[model samples]
Target: MGKISYYTEEGLNRLKAELTDLKTKGRAEIARQIAEARDKGDLSENAEYDAAKDAQGLHELKISKLEEVLANARVLDESTIDASQVSVLSKVKIKNKKNGAEVSYTLVSEEEADLKAGRISVGSPIGKGLLGKRVGDVAEIKVPAGVMEFEVVEIAR
Candidate 1:
């Protein structure tokens, strides 16, 4: 079994929709391509047929992976989240100890992470370091550059 991952209701719904689309429209498109290629005749010498077959294999693999991900997904109720400490779905404000810069990010599952929107994955280095930490606690995180220190300024749901 795959490891279980928690997601917000919206995130889980989005994932389910994507899986449904892949299983329906995606598979239909691939099947259509294969049918068109086969109509060319002489499958042994048709490069289009070979390419279509390869594409179908890749498409099925993607569907399988998506199914596995859905199987292990667990939706978490946002109302139950505690704001007293850093955790998934918590919007946390932190100050960089080195440069005195401040930024806020919402900790989310890997599937919901969008850095441009200030959403980060709890599996990330900084997120992991901040997990379970309360305001006024310092988190030391190791990144590709080096170890950086950040002080938790606030946590909110």
Candidate 2:
């Protein structure tokens, strides 16, 4: 119903591919599983059939959600992005105000957030606080642990 905002072109394509997979490959797999289970025994008391039906329901739910995402997805243009401030799709380098430890994070969409890969969702607490911040600005972001402050060291495209 609402827009599915994305940070990069690649991320949008990935979502589309996932949607296609769910519609095609995923559907085929579920159908096969259901058919196999159906062949096992009587429908009323068949545990395998019940389990397969449940799996089908869950798979359909995923497909529905994926379709919604694909319908609303808007891919961001990389060339038009301004690097003067911390914004979505920007690679931001920040320094901890208290500890002075520096780290770099690529701001992305919620679906693309991978902490291990240093990609953070723009809607996240830290990312929300960092948005629109220019170099030398301090972003006071609240986390589950406590409030942490990060100084914007650099913003890159």
Candidate 3:
């Protein structure tokens, strides 16, 4: 069994949509490529055929992985989330202790993480450090650069 991961409604829906697209449109496209390559000539000497076959394998692997993720995914109700502490789906504002720069990030599942969108995976170093921390708490996170200190400024659903 895969480890269960919590997601927001929008994130779960997006994952389902992607899985559907991969199984339908994505599989059809790969099948078409394989057929076209097969029609060219001998399979042994045809690099296109080999490439198409490889692509099909990769595509199927992606589908399988996605299915597993969906199976273990549980949607978290925003209303039920605790606003007092940082956790998955919690929008947290943290201030860098050194520079006093503040940034907001929503903790999400690995599949739902998008740095540009201010969503971060709970598995990330910073996210792990911030988990369960309440406002005014300091989180010491170890990144590739070094250990950085951040103070939890706010937590919201």
- How does candidate 3 fare on TM-score? 0.95
Q: Which ten residues in a row have the lowest lDDT in candidate 1?
A: 76-85
Q: Can you write out model 2's per-residue Cα lDDT over 1-157, one digit (the tens) per residue?
A: 6776774778877888888898899889999998998898789999988988899999999989888877787888877778788789999999999899999999999999999999999999999999999999998889998999999999998
Rank ordering of all candidates by TM-score, starting from the highest: 1, 3, 2
**Candidate 2 residue spans exceeding 4 A from truth:** none
Q: How many residue pairs clash in each candidate?
A: 0, 0, 0
Q: Write the per-residue lDDT of candidate 3 for residues 39-138, one digit (tens) a residue.
A: 9989999999999999999999999999999999998987887789998989999999999999999999988899999999999999999999999999
Q: Which stretches of candidate 3 lie over 4 Å from their true place?
A: none
User: Which regions of candidate 1 fall more than 4 Å away from where they truly are?
Assistant: none
Per-prediction TM-score, please? 0.97, 0.95, 0.95
> Which clashing pairs does model 1 show?
none
Residue 124 of model 2 has an lDDT of 94
Candidate 1 displacement at residue 59 in angstroms: 0.8
Which ten residues in a row are the worst by lDDT in model 3? 75-84
Q: Over the stretch 1-157, how does candidate 1's per-residue lDDT look in tens digits?
A: 9999999989999999999999999999999999999999999999999999999999999999989999999998877877799999999999999999999999999999999999999999988999999999999999999999999999999
Residue 73 lDDT, candidate 3, scale 0-100: 91
**What are the clashing pairs of model 2?**
none
